[model samples]
Target: MRVPIYQVDAFTKRRFAGNPAAVVVLPSFPSDTVMRAVAAENNLAETAFLVQEEGQYHLRWFTPAVEVPLCGHATLATAAVVMERLSPNLGGVVFQTASGELPVARSADGYVLDFPSRPSEKVSSPPDVSKALGIMPTEVYRNQFNYLAVLDDARNVRDLQPDLVAIAGLDRSGIIVTAPGDDGYDFVSRYFAPAKGVPEDPVTGAAHCMLAPYWAERSGRSSFVAYQASRRGGEVVCRLCGDRVELEGSCVFYLEGQADISL
Candidate 1:
């Protein structure tokens, strides 16, 4: 079988700057083993698979190591592929995913994603957090999926060199380091999920689900321009609305091809 595949750089207008995710448009859902093997073979941070059902889509995301419940950048990448390449006239799409129903709408420039808000609760720092990140965070918070480490400044967040092994050993699947941003951005962050096969994510959209609510509470504002400070940095516009977070970003298509697989 020849499966259609596309690679897109999410959260960036230019190529190679954002997180690249491979999107496979499949006629039907494949086996878990097959999907996992495809993700491993692609070797990207995440691979998104989509199957049309009842005029909507069922989406699943996988890291090279494991399947994740939620992934923002890959979701955005899948939206791009569906709207731009597959159906140009389509204005929006809803994806039924492990996280829930995710809606993507087209904007003048790119797309806006309506994602579930993930509010983290403040907590005492874990013993290994400082050792893992090599710097003590001013505060720590925990949610169901990740640990949020608040730093004093963006420089510390940008310059951090963490012990990936220690990070992997943390209780949470991922750790997000964040601080106030300069250069007109509201906040800057970096994400590490070594246990999930992503040592450092370039531009994480899912991380901002926790970030938007936290920053809104801190600054008394509900909207923000966030930057993920990685080697290939990307920007995201976020807003908190009740129980949902609106994330906006653009995508750049990099590769389009077919994956030949034996059924």
Candidate 2:
């Protein structure tokens, strides 16, 4: 079988700067095992697979090791592929996913992802959490998806070098370390999900689902511009609505190729 694949860098205008995701547009759904094998072979933070059904797309995301319910960067990259290649005249696309229906629209700035807001509740930091992170956060919060660690400074977020093994031991899907931005941006963050096979994500849109609400209450603002302080950094624009969050960012196309796999 021959599968068309595109590698796109999400949340950045330039290549090799943001989180790269592999997007495969399928004529029909493949078996879970084949999809998992393809994702493992891609070996990026996330690989997105989509199939059109009844005029809408059904999307799924996979890491090298596991399939996740939701993924922001990969979703953004998928939207780009749908808009640019699949349907150039399309102003927007609605995707049915494990997390639910996600919609992406083209905007003047870039692409806007309409995602559910994930507000976190205050919680005590787990002892191992600090040990894994190598530094204690000022406060801790938990949502359905990840643990949000509020640090004192953005520099701390940028400079962190966590023990991946220890992080893998923590009982959470992922960990998000964040702080107030120093520059024009509102906040900054870094994500670690060793358990899910992503040691660190360069630019995470899913983390912002929690961060948007967290910062909105703290900063008393509904809109924000955020920066992910990874080695290959990128930018995210966020806005918190009552029950949803709007994330905006651009994508850079890196490569397009065919993957040959035996059926």
Candidate 3:
């Protein structure tokens, strides 16, 4: 069958400035192997697939190597695909996912995603961790994903050369290093998920689940803007609540095509 697919640049208006996600709004979910092959072929960090069911959509995310429980930018891309291509006339949509239920609403400004706020716990930085990162961080912590490194400044967040092979061996999924921004943004971050096959995620909304709250308390700012320092930068607006976090960003559809596969 010929399946329709879309390539969206999440968190940026420009085509190549943000994280590229392959969104496939399929009539039905494909097989696990097929989905993995599609993601590998697309060669992006995440590929999102969705099918409507019971007034909500069943959404699944696949990396080239594995399927993740949740993915923020790809979720945003799925919402954009639903708003513009899947069901263009619909007001909004909800996704039933492995991470429970996720909702997406269409706003005049942009899309807002309500996700669980994962507060990190402060911990001593392992000497090897800093050596693997090639920079010494001011502080280190463990979030749900992996180590969270608070650098001296945003410049440090961008300047370090990560030892990806060594990082992959550390444990957990990956690491996120961040610091306060110097310019317009409130904070800057870079994600390294070698276990997930992503050395440096261009824009990681998922990482900010921990970053937003950590910096919010430190900076005395409840709401803040974050930027990923990857070469293709992406923007994120985040709000830290008691136990919930909200992320807002825009997604631009770069291309729409068809996937030919034998079933």
Candidate 4:
């Protein structure tokens, strides 16, 4: 079957600037092997699968190498697809995902994704983590993604050049280096997941699930701006509301294609 595919640049208003996510909206669930092959064929960071069921959309994320449990940018990109294509008047979209029920609403500013509060617990980063990076963070914490390294400044986050081989040896999801943003934005961050085949993600939305709340408290602003200082940079509008976080960003449709895959 020729599955309709969409390529979107998430977290940025400009085309070809933000993290790109390939979206495949299938009439029904496709075979695992077929989906993986489709994702691999796309060769993007994450390919989102969307299917409608019981009045809600079922969403799944797949990296170029493997399927992931949760993904933020692609989710936002899916919301954009739904609004722009599936239902222009959806007003809001609900995604029943592995993480749980997630809602994306169209706000005056942009699309707001209400995600669960993923607060990283205060903990010590593994020594091997810093050893691998050749630098230590001022503070460390633990979350679903591994170590959250609080750097001295945004420049440090930008200056990180880790030994990918050593990073792959560590027992962690990935390392997040963050510091206050110099560009009008609240904070700047970069994600490294060599273990997962992505040496450095251009703009990691899931990592910021924790990052939004973490910086919100420190910056003492319920609403703040953020920038992912990756080579293919992106920007995000974040809001902290109690234990939940609202991550907002724009998505640009880059291309449309077809994936012919059969089980």
Tens-place lDDT per residue, model 2, 16-104, is 89999999988887888988889899999999998998888999999999999999999999999999988999999999998899999
User: Which clashing pairs does model 2 show?
Assistant: none
Off by over 4 Å in 4: none
CA lDDT scores, all candidates in order: 0.95, 0.92, 0.87, 0.85
Stretches off by above 4 angstroms in model 1 are none
- Residue 135 local lDDT, model 1: 92
Quick one: RMSD of model 4?
1.5
Error of 3 at 232 (Å): 0.1
Writing each residue's lDDT as its tens digit, candidate 3 over 99-162 gives 8788888877679888888898998888878988998889998966778988978888888789
- Candidate 4 lDDT over 69-104, as tens digits, reads 788899989999999888998889899998899999
Model 3 spans with C-alpha error above 4 angstroms: none
The number of the candidate with the highest lDDT is 1
On a 0 to 100 scale, what is the lDDT of residue 190 in model 2? 95
Candidate 3 lands at a TM-score of 0.96
Weakest lDDT window of 10 consecutive positions for candidate 2: 254-263
Clashes of 2: 0
TM-score of each: 0.98, 0.98, 0.96, 0.95
- Each model's total of backbone clashes: 0, 0, 0, 0
| Residue 108 of model 1, lDDT score | 89
Native-to-model Cα distance after best TM-score fit, residue 120 in candidate 4, in Å: 1.3
